[model samples]
Target: MQSSLPPPSRGRGRATRERSTVPRSVSAHQEAVRSLLQAPLSAAGPAAELPLARARGLVLARDVTAPVSLPPFANSQMDGFAVRSADLAAGRPLPVAEPVPAGADPGPLRPGWAAPVMTGAKMPAGADAVVPVERADPPRFPDASAAAEVLLPQTAPGTYVREPGSDIAAGARALPAGTVLGPAQLGLLAALGLTTAPVRDAPAPRVLLVATGDEVVAPGTALPEGKIFDANGTILHAALAEAGVEVVDGGLVPDDPGVLRQLIREYAPSVDLVLTTGGVSMGAYEVVRQAMADQPVDFLSVAMQPGGPQGIGTVDGTAFLGFPGNPVSALVSFEMFLRPALSELRGLPQPRPVVRARLAERTDSPPNKHQVRRGVYAEGTVRLVGGPGSHLVSALAASNALVHIPEGRGAVEAGEDVTAWLL
Candidate 1:
């Protein structure tokens, strides 16, 4: 039976321990997780004035108006002679003015004379066109102070001249609030003479990560007869890092609840959230559930395959999230829940790109649960990688997309369209 939960949360909200064992819907659990994190995230805050180098991936806090137009003044786009287009009509040599190197204020052009302009040099006022040096007589700039003359070809006005505000006008919006800073956006700011931008570089929650279960052994060590390498810690750590969260590796904790409690009690003060992988399923040695029995966080059975079992709540004032022992389930949990919360709170433009694609193979899913299947998304189609099992790490590795099979969808046809999230 489904639990009759409230729209927001139930009870003192603090005392919202599991009142029923019935599974919650995937979206319901996602909202629960987000509601739990909203406060600390707000406490962590936003709105920082960061330099251009550090503002990438952050959202603009306010509209950035251009201080000066792009290419504030007219400039040459080539190493050529800046001349009055009318003066060059005769194709005759004219007295060469001072050489205008980049960054120099050469001066206004005198009628009937040409100014030797290097690339990006300010075009002398009154000069309307540029004739590439190769097209001029002798094809070389005359020595400064040498009383030289040069020839130029007739060219239309504005040739090779980058006019002011051609890219963006002065006092116009360069970027609007909520625009994520990227290379192109940052470059535009630099061109606008801005050294820094006011951005919403909200604090990335500091997570204390622990890998649980006696069956988990650190990588590079002996894999005993019954033990496997710990892929969860590495996977979760890498994912959290990519999302910009500061991760503190808490290493492995055995199935013993005392050790788990001690580790959390000690590190709870230093971290904004506590994350653990394994021991959340319905097994005899479910250490995470055993340890969090008294905490206000709820141990939920979400209506989702693979990652159905979840533990989310607070432990000693530190937010907590628990994922199943299976590698695939753990990652799916991160993708479906934690990643979205972090991205929303951090103000990222898009946490992940979701697309609709045609399925390349037939599949079956439970009608009551949402299913996430690993697939290879290409050319608007998604092909399943392996059997829909939670332990298929090899198949997960070979996949680049997560095909989302929504609740109530079952027995999907080969050519049916499905929603996919690009990794």
Candidate 2:
């Protein structure tokens, strides 16, 4: 007999939140990406003989304990006479006995006499105070060692002596785990006498990039009618590279489902993610969407102009994200989705810092879709690089930011506040 449960409970209605069917804008897409990537990732494992030189930008996997106390000894902090403060009177110069230099542990302080000490020298036993060398007149040189008798003024205990464990106590933690190895952290660890550190391995995700279109040709190649040089490939490639991703760079794939499917199947296992451009929309010759039909693909018409079409899914445990064919759209999709996703999985602070700027002039756009208009932000103002068209390469070349204008908004007047994502 099959195990059967009782009837449903009345409170089950509260178990699930109502799903909103409203089209998600570009901001919403970015928010979804931000939320989905909030899960923690595995950190690097510990190892002996770790090469710190090769661990730049890696997070520490374990705490670094101090093997020895900082300063490691009670030493002199200044070149002065080491003396017992008890010997100091209201008005008097103490007699100088032995001279102590750095690196040599001076024996116990000679009774009734002060010792001339150099900076970093271990304080003689029972030494209470240090009279700076300059403070002594004629400089005190004990019998036969030097001529002038050094006269030191009365001094106080604990003066000019570096106490043991003053910098860091022995067995103290030098640096905590999960610290991104920076110059300061490295220096601190070195100061703690750590020649090696345990750091997490940086998981560099292998990615396959495919730019698809019959009209897209390689740059510097002869252009035929109705064909343009591919810009999305280079743009997305650079973005992925900066984010520490390894790209296969499959280049352009003609609008052929057979080739696309074969490429997807062949490259999926080797790469952690497959990124494709174009051929996912409602266009008649859309090959990527057709080819991916056999796989788990989520076709989304995100409420964003220029880059509203997108596809995301998993094929045999390898993820695939399909972006629009336009250069600006592809880049915006990366900035909105993949960048933040990878940053989360890779344990970065934040993908990129977004700034707010004003439009330098008036511009009109669709009210239903959030538009990503390319522009240059300068002098506390943002000037549109060109018209709000995604195919304008010249405009994109001049742009350093993508200004996000929200949906249900039409013409943006000059000097209006707009959220800008830096490129």
Candidate achieving the largest TM-score: 1
Model 1 agreement with the true structure over 117-187: per-residue lDDT tens digits: 99999999999999999988889888796999887777999999999999899999999987888999999
Instruction: Give the TM-score comparing model 1 with the true structure, all chains together.
Output: 0.84
- Model 1: residues >4 Å from true position, as ranges? 1-22, 44-60, 86-97, 111-114, 133-156, 179-188, 199-203, 360-362, 378-383, 411-416
- Give every collision pair in model 1: 297-313
Weakest lDDT window of 10 consecutive positions for candidate 1:
1-10
lDDT of 2: 0.75
Best by lDDT: 1
Clashes of 1: 1
- 14 Cα displacement, candidate 1 (Å): 8.5
Candidate 2 per-residue C-alpha lDDT over 1-423 given as tens digits, one digit per residue, 9 for 90 to 100: 001111212211111111225555554455444433333223333443466676666667778888989888888888878888777774566566768888897789877677888888888888977888777775534554663346667777788888989988899887786566778887777777777788766567788999999999999999999998999899999999988788898988999999988888899888878889998777889877888876767667777777888776665556777888888788878876788767756655465667888889998878988777888998678888887776787888888887877777889999998877777
Evaluate all candidate structures by whole-model CA lDDT and list the values in order. 0.86, 0.75
Poorly placed runs, candidate 2 (over 4 Å): 1-22, 31-49, 62-193
